[model samples]
Target: MNDRLNLFQAARFGSPFGSPFGSPFGSPFGSPFDLAHQAGEYWLDAWQRSVLFMDAMRQRGDDHEEKLTQAAPHVLNFEFDVVMDGRDLARPVNYSLLRIHTPEGVVVDANRRPFIVFDPRAGHGPGIGGMKHDSEIGVVLRAGHPCYFVGFLPQPVHGQTIEDVCQAEARFIAKVAELHPDADGKPALIGNCQAGWQIMMTSALNPDLTGPLVLAGTPLSYWAGVRGKNPLRYLGGLLGGTWLTAFTGDLGCGIFDGANLVSNFESMNPANTWWKKEYKVYSEIDTEAERYLEFEKWWGNPVLLNAQEMQYIADNLFVGNRLSSGSIHDSAGRRIDLRNVKSPVVVFCSWGDDVTPPQQALGWVLDMYQDDDAMALSGQTIIYALHETIGHLGIFVSATVANKEHEEFTGAMDLIDVLPPGLYEAVFVEKTKDTVNAGLVDGNYVVRFERRFLDDVRALGGNDQEDERRFAAVARLSDVNLGLYRTFASPLVKAAINEQGAEWLRQLHPYRLRYKLFSSKSPLLFGIAGAAERVRAQRAPAKPDNVFTMLQEAWSRQVVGVLDQYRDLRDSAVERYFMNVYGSPVLQALVGLRADDGRVRQLGRDIARETVAASARAKLVEQAGVGGTPEAIIRALLYVLRAPELRAADERGYAMLRELRTHSEEGKVMSLAHFKDVVQQQAQILSWNEEAGFVALPLLLPPSSAEREHALDVVRQVAGAAGELEGEAAERMARIAAMFSAAVKLAG
Candidate 1:
């Protein structure tokens, strides 16, 4: 065995197998082994390159610090006023009180429309949505809309419950509304990531205040995932449920470090965290590294949450899955039911987001509402968009995503608001320059979207109950464990902690300790400057195509693969162990001891019945002549079937229908009120048919333009053919031609 080991070692980096010089484990100044010499040389060269890279980074940091100090004089820094006096920094942005004061500000002189843009409070500091020229706030302001930001402080507010934070957001919205008495629409709410669900909860609780809501990269259904994939969903069960979170928060005397969350995110992609990101910086050290480091600085800085808040999130959201299940209730006995939210909900998720898998991000809709009928019964319009390959942060942070997904979404916000209360999928179809007509309102863009059915969303990721059931089991176990922990362990832990102990614990936190201790202020870093200069002067970077460099890259990849495999093994073992332990029938029986006293079940049944009744009433209204006439309906249906070549034509038709309906419902005096009402009612009825030309055109157009034109010609031919029939069918053909003429004029 010793001989074999010796031979292996020698083959790897000794004598003729190693490089002539600079080999990782070869003779100091002599030629290494010939056969595998390049491998040793590569390892040595990579090490040299890494040392030089570190030196470069230190120098760059020094330069950036100097530049930041110089630019401080020119930069305009804004201050925020904190509502709750806490250790954390919670500063609100100072914007014009009147909507008319800002370019994007819109105050419907008739009714104030309050708009809140809740930026994600992840590891990064606030202001991404409102920081730049072309941002969420900018977009809203450009449209003459009122905007408010929910910004948090650098530190967390002591004892701040997530509920308290939510309440504060609600108060802000209410205040904005009060300031503008005559706004036309309810306040439009936009939430990104962490803030997405936060706003959702606020909206669900105070449904009356919210209008259209956009939830980007927000994971409402946390436990929803596909097998083997979305390994992050299995983390809670793997880590012994929320016990570790409780322990950490206890150690900090109630503050749970946000750094831990950031760390978990980083761990998801070892390649990015350990190699790709840093290597990209080193490879493009002159410029790319600066931006990489700037982002890393924010990515590294994590915030804190109160123990109670973290505990609630873990039990109710992550593990318990109670939010979607309609089992969660606020302190005041108000059930935090997602189904109660009346406004249109826009869900933006991506397939590549491991942190918030597509399932976790959208599965809540399936969980809360069994089908489109249930969603319609609740008077909710839920539209979701699925991106093929953007990561969690990229969904909100990436410039490309901002330009495409966000831009298109903002433009279509009004269209989304008018969609009939039902479940629909927003599909973004790529369009070519040649396909775009010059007369269109939107500029030449490569993509356009159309609303689709829930089946399209289901097709993207199969909506199966079996995987969700496993998560449901996790949720059940979490409740029992949390109850036991609170009753038996929380008191003991709390008693052991004090202010000083909490401070010490925070200082000792793995994330905080690294930044606090290793910074330039640290005494040990006194010699870092001199050492960095020496390293910079002796820098030797590896050549991209060198045999030695290639070998080094291969070894690095192997190491990464091994690490990933080990992590997978560890995660698998942990999940299996916990699931087995917690999923035991004995434990389940103990947990089920406090099962609902039947009142909750009865109440749900009552609510469901009321919802069904209301839905039926709405359907009746739709069916009656009160909304529109039978002749008008036939006309609209024919127009929809015949006109298949228009751009954004379906949405435009829907918009026109919505406007007409709104005017008619308001009883507003207009010269063409009756005509508009008749046309809109017909449009609404036609919109219901999934097989309508407008509905199918977006999906069918790609086959071939000739085929599409042929389809359109066929519709016209059918109309002409219908003219040949006598009596009712002949009258229908005449109405169809009239409707087509009116629609074409409106579209034109």
Candidate 2:
């Protein structure tokens, strides 16, 4: 054995072998001895990484166990006191409303609008919204807003339903409003992922309860997605529409294990879930363990839901796609129309979010209104912002986003609340050295509201008529399958299992078993902690230039590439299969659907209401030449900045406007609501007839030369706060100035 080892080592290092083969290659790469030494170091480092990786797994399992022991098991990093418990409400649920204790050195304004963050209850436990210092709750608090959190327990209340939860949320909002009676506006509601639709429904039913609403990575139009890009939408049809969900719920004996949903999410990205995630931690075990373990504390602890809640979500929202279509109703049987939401809605979604793509986030606007005119006439202010590339969770939890997107959204809440009722795209651009009025800008970025049309939304991509028909067929078939199962299979399945048996099944689930198997209490991880400690004391991480480390990373990339390809192929095949099965005329006919008519469930137009709105707009247009300085200045500004492309604004300009409001005679007497009304009225007048609106602009201005000059100066200050007007904006501004000058000469 010694002689063989010697021979092998010598041949590899060119000691015993002839010099030509090893000597020639070794010059460009490295000396054989140098390579051998580096290889030995890599092996040692790999050994250390293995021990450290096992230790991280053990610590993660330990953390999961610790979380399970807590009564609420929330991941919120901030300390909070429970203001109201859902169990004490008329409609009991597992959720609770918490008032986040203001962090030291952070001063909160009592008169500012209070912020309530509603975290999603889809599969995972609550508190991802505030799990880190740079999170949704953190941003709200730092912005001097009174912050509140709506979180839930790991276990659901025994008889809780989705309706009960929605009711509970409404009550919570009312309580927040009542608590802050001196606040300038109603409480701003921030919803993440699943909570987005939930809050939207509650707001629709009780339209007056909320202020501006921020929905981050929310999916309202569940059935809307591109053809091959979204395969998760095809799952309902492939599984034959909600039957498996029903079966799984039945197997849980009235309780549904959220692990099932978590598993599905993991399946979406097998490369990340199974290999790359853990491998990255292993490769950088010295530094990555803490982050991996912290995230696992939330990701590993899947929360429970009552079977009824899951069924409603699957049947009504996921497969049925009823919410966006206005088919969902309250207990009073009133249709839950999205138009009923009185507050301005700011939707923040990402293009790279496969889970809740921009299509799903913004498609609801297309579903609710037929055109830009319909939306404007409905008196709903909708603003949507798109990120170039961010994943679903990153939309709310990422530190980078919290600093940029969430920060701007919250900072501009007051501005959004007073926006005229219409569709606008929120655009954010970086502040540069040459940016006009640089001192007026607040931060590294400037945010502006750009007017948009329905076509702008359609450009994001959505389903065709055939796709809608196919999804509708799936919805119809889902109802039939759910009914059949409830009648035939549910009773038998429920009878076979009780609560204790269900608990056993849940504990034995593959997702849960992995955590338990690697826990500190498990026999398998007996010596891992001590071994890891020893390795840590003698730690030696490999350098990036190490040959073995490079090979390891290369192998990992190849693995990920292969898995990604498999996912694409699988998704493509699944999409095609679904289209074929659900699009068949025979299947569609059986499911009581028709290809000739592509209209799925949608709210019919209320001609009477629209007629009343049109009349109101006409009356406003007839009086377009009315109002004094405020109306004229605002109208002139809107006219000059009327191009379809995005424009920029700063908070300082809004602040200046507010100061103007406080100092002026008309501003001191007018209320915020009245100001919004005036802005909207003037905007309508301009839309009706731009040329006539411009012709009547001087009529709206005061006859006194000084007053007219003051109003024009304010417009120039506010408009120029962004920068010197350019191109058409500059020409328009010049025209307005010329109009004012001519009006002044006549007055003289």
Candidate 3:
């Protein structure tokens, strides 16, 4: 027994292949016989788990094949009918628009603004937006809004381009609007991940066709990231630009496999991709199989992109980073400016999203506008919501987010629509005992829009001027290398590969091959299915307290720790390498990167528009003493909250305002669009001349003392909805109340 104990300790602590952290076995703590028994049990349980895991993989492969056999395959939890197929359109693409069937108990209001969810075709196929019950589509449907989904087929239409896809999406939006002419507003557009940027481009091209736009986990400013953190941004610099992209397309016979993009994503987190994910399922095979298979159903099934579409994305957006700069032009040379998107745009991003960090997700705002004033001048209401800790996929997939953030956004769509043109951050604060008017708040949190500025966005980590220069150099080099590849290599490569060979290569890709090898198709895995069933019937999982089980878990953790360290070191090295190579003066010169080119590139402001805006501001100042209760109440609220800080506008306040407008004698005639115009006009008046605007506030109020008192009461309720006004806000409120009272008394 003593000898056996010694040997076990030696193997655990002293072996060269022991845990990455030095073992802590200086003395024996358990009976040798008991330890041996537990170890034997653990091994048996592990063997069962391994068989079950193999069975799960086989099932995943079977599902993949089944999905391949279907037309417009998706993982949406609800039933949907195809409304419009892009393949049937004049400019055919592989996308389709589907109207989701409402759940059994839910009733969708056709008169409510419709919602259209556009899923990302990044690497995986579509349906993630509506993959679960508590998802984007689910929330909209539950709220009685008619929901539509835009998804793509696994294969692209031949000779398709990104331009064709955008045009098709615009047509779909128009069709949805036409279908719901009685709807209160245009259909709200929701884009997730890669789809977010795509919809933005489409909206820019056809602004009038879209309504409010919601972008979840989208990366628009691709090059924007903190140094030493986002190594993927350095990929272009490390690879010497997009020549390899062209090479891959040529090898695909003019089609690019999305599996390559999925592989790149998997490579980002080696520990999760290689071990943690599989190990978790293996350990919890009894409970986790369904979820694991469901997720794999989407991740493993990669769609295809036309080579032209891929090249356009790689050149103009990813490496070029020109979308936000308004550098991309249509076939007719029409500039695609984000400012052209007239509807309110809401961006939902997360700090924990390594794939699309807050910097990349929100950096486009900074690129397009120099300041808050510039954004407001464009008459665009842009709202961004930042999550404290959620990954890229969780921004759309996580049920918790769908129920809370999405629910609040949808519930307050009208409030957002009527917001004055400015930069605002959507903050969802949890309600507690301290929350005032908690009953009035929706859900578990108080959803509020806090005004923000360009500087706030800059505070989030992003590329400095030096980083910009390096990225600029990378883009220029990519163009040159792409030209060289097209001239010398593409033709030869294309000639060497045909459709049949390309299909073979795709089937043999490592990501796809693993699934095929584990499935029933592989003779080696033929017996795993039956074996797993037998094991499941007679399962005997080891206790968590078992010594061997504890040791196994420790070892797994150690492995993850080691891989994380490696990833950190690798990312740091890549960042340094990119900076050293691209920052070189010679390389910059070779790539035609000028010294002054480090400045953030944006479209030159339209002189004609600027003149109009200037005249409009002057006109607003002249009409500072505007007419009626709506303008007076709005102007009063604006005056109290005009400081350079975040101002909270809660749903309860908007609800009260909405009720007031509906029942009030004077406000009943004001339409939402007309009310929005009044709000903006009053806001501009205050912005131009604060003192004069404040003095003129009472002049806009009704002469009747009772009417003036009621208007003041409405303003107080709306302003105090967030909380009791404090400090400057409190003083401003007092002054406005006093001014209103004095004006009423003088009129009497």
Candidate 4:
């Protein structure tokens, strides 16, 4: 545990490694003379930190090598004793199936349900999902769910393929299901980043294997990104194609280093990568060492992917964006479609995540379904939640996020299943409890589903038809480049490189070399670790009031600012070159991609429209404005409670209305979907002419006096569901409630 010293505590901004404290609040230095007197101490402190910084760097590198060395081949970063290894699976892949061992005193109910989590295999090693106490696995286990993990080995099996991995995953889910016979549903699958798409593929091919699927910071539409931003998406087109991936793999003797992927990610944010990340650790080494080292343990452990696997992923998924287009096929030649997924999908994304922005995370909905009605008629529930600002890794491991978002989401999975089959935004609203609605809430917040449409996904800054054309062109170019490379370049590259040489080259990568050279094994950094130890005994962190401390922070900020500008400039140049090259109509036509990008989206719209038309004749007719008297009143009430912008959708209120509806002999068997439809119709009606809605209330109200009083009581309960409804909402709710009450008493 790192010490929590408030040396530089001011504005708190969290980094991936740790939420570092800001510069000191007020000046402690009384005068220039006073500051000058302590200058010698400041200089000493600076020198000490510099030495410690180098020593820590050496330790980080040494730690990286030591961890790899000590782990005699089977390195499960997770705290799990492998019960069912991938080697024992039906079609064994590089991945292993392990049951996460619950910590002592964390009594998990074995029969409740199993929660299987897959960490992203992008570049880093597995176990990040379980890296902290407050995490996806941790919350689920505490909530009494049996937990399982799908992790991969450092090295791939000789003939392993993605298809084999997906098949193996299905077998893993089957085993989990076999273990928990009493679970209400199948294992709830949680996939972070890269694992997200894999889970979707597994669930799509084997529909019976999964329950609800949670995809956190995962991009299904690989080409989906905002313009002038998310430059990582531009690399394929800028570099001509994924031919580089093949060339890289060939140089590595048919293996792709995960470190290379990690380096690419680091390059995206130079401010963090070049300066701020290390500076933070160096400045607060005494208090940040534990966290820095913990994160590094996983960060340093880069796994390997087979050359074929890399080629397939880069060609089919990344550059081609084939998943969204449904062009990718399984081993059985059946198309792997997102629409084929039987389980509900819960997509959680953050606006702050540049890697997998909200556009990339949720844009597939628009690519798959043409309109909201088509989505609603599919009988598949897709729920999405967007955060204001949390970075990619924060989605998986941030303590505050894990407790709030993951906690609420996991708690509501049962409710998610029972929800009407449609597109919904799973909204979490903070509980004010100012009103008498305490009985309605179980905790400090309430989770509700707001109806969403395909347009809502399109609004996230992706979905440009023209930009997708360029990506399609890149896919075509990639095939050509990869073919040429394999024919002309691969043999020579492979001949020159063996396993030993490839390993040596990978270790020589800049990211790895930085750590390797900083270690104590290097004579230049000799005795530094020992000197740091001696300095630690009389260590003194600079006072924030100190002028020198302020100057140091200012210098760091300036350096980071310059790096950020450079990153922006580099990204601009990259995007410009990619657009200019790939956006050429002649070039696109030559590559046979001129018509593809346009056709994919058009086909999606056509399928959705056709599905709606064909299914509508066979489907049940909607029951909006058709339910009996009680439903009319409840629907009217739903309209009023929608506040100004129609924000709050109280599940408890909906429950209360259903309970009340039972009092009268009307709408007893009405499904929630029918109720929702009625609510939407009524809201629309009220929006047209608010006074007309009030005047028309008498028709919906019961003629009998006793029933009129009963309806008013239900209205009161629904209105008060959120507790202490305030402002305009409370006033509107009261006015509407009174109108219905009056209409009921005076009904003809």
TM-score of every candidate: 0.73, 0.94, 0.94, 0.82
**How do the residues 542-632 of candidate 3 rate in per-residue lDDT, one tens digit apiece?**
9776767766776788789899999999898998899899999899988787766648455677777689888887787679876777788
* Sliding window of 10 residues with minimal summed lDDT for model 3: 20-29
Arranged by lDDT, best first? 3, 2, 4, 1
Q: What is the lDDT of candidate 1?
A: 0.58
Candidate 2 clashing pairs, residues 3+ apart or interchain: none
Write out the backbone clash pairs for model 3.
none
Off by over 4 Å in 3: 1-29, 596-600, 643-646, 663-669
Candidate 4's C-alpha runs over 4 A off are: 1-35, 70-78, 593-720, 723-748
Off by over 4 Å in 1: 1-115, 122-124, 128-147, 178-184, 436-438, 441-451, 454-469, 523-551, 578-590, 593-603, 606-612, 615-623, 627-735, 738-748
lDDT string for model 4 (415-525, tens) is 565445567798777877453455665546678777766777777777467787777788888889988988998888888889999989898888788878878788879
The lDDT leader among the candidates is 3
What does candidate 2's lDDT look like per residue over 1-748, in tens digits? 5543433344343434445434555442246666787788899999999988988999888988898899989789999999999999887899999999999999999878999999999998889999998999999999999999999998999899988998999999999999999888899999999999999999998998899999999999999999888888888999989988889998988888999988988999989998999999999887899898888989999999998899999988889898898888777788888888989999999988989989999999988888777777667899999998998878987999999999888888877887777888888888888876666666577778878889999998899888898999999998899889989988899899988999999999999989999989999889999998899899887777666676677678879989999999999899999999998999999998865675765668867667887788778667778877778887887777664432433565665566445423444755556666666777777766778888899888787999888888887787767656778778888999999888888998
Listing every candidate in turn, what is its Cα RMSD in Å to the true structure after a full C-alpha superposition? Answer: 9.4, 4.3, 4.4, 8.0
- Summed backbone clashes in each candidate are 29, 0, 0, 3
Candidate 4 local Cα displacement, residue 529, angstroms? 2.7
Q: Assess each prediction's global lDDT (C-alpha) against the native.
A: 0.58, 0.85, 0.86, 0.75
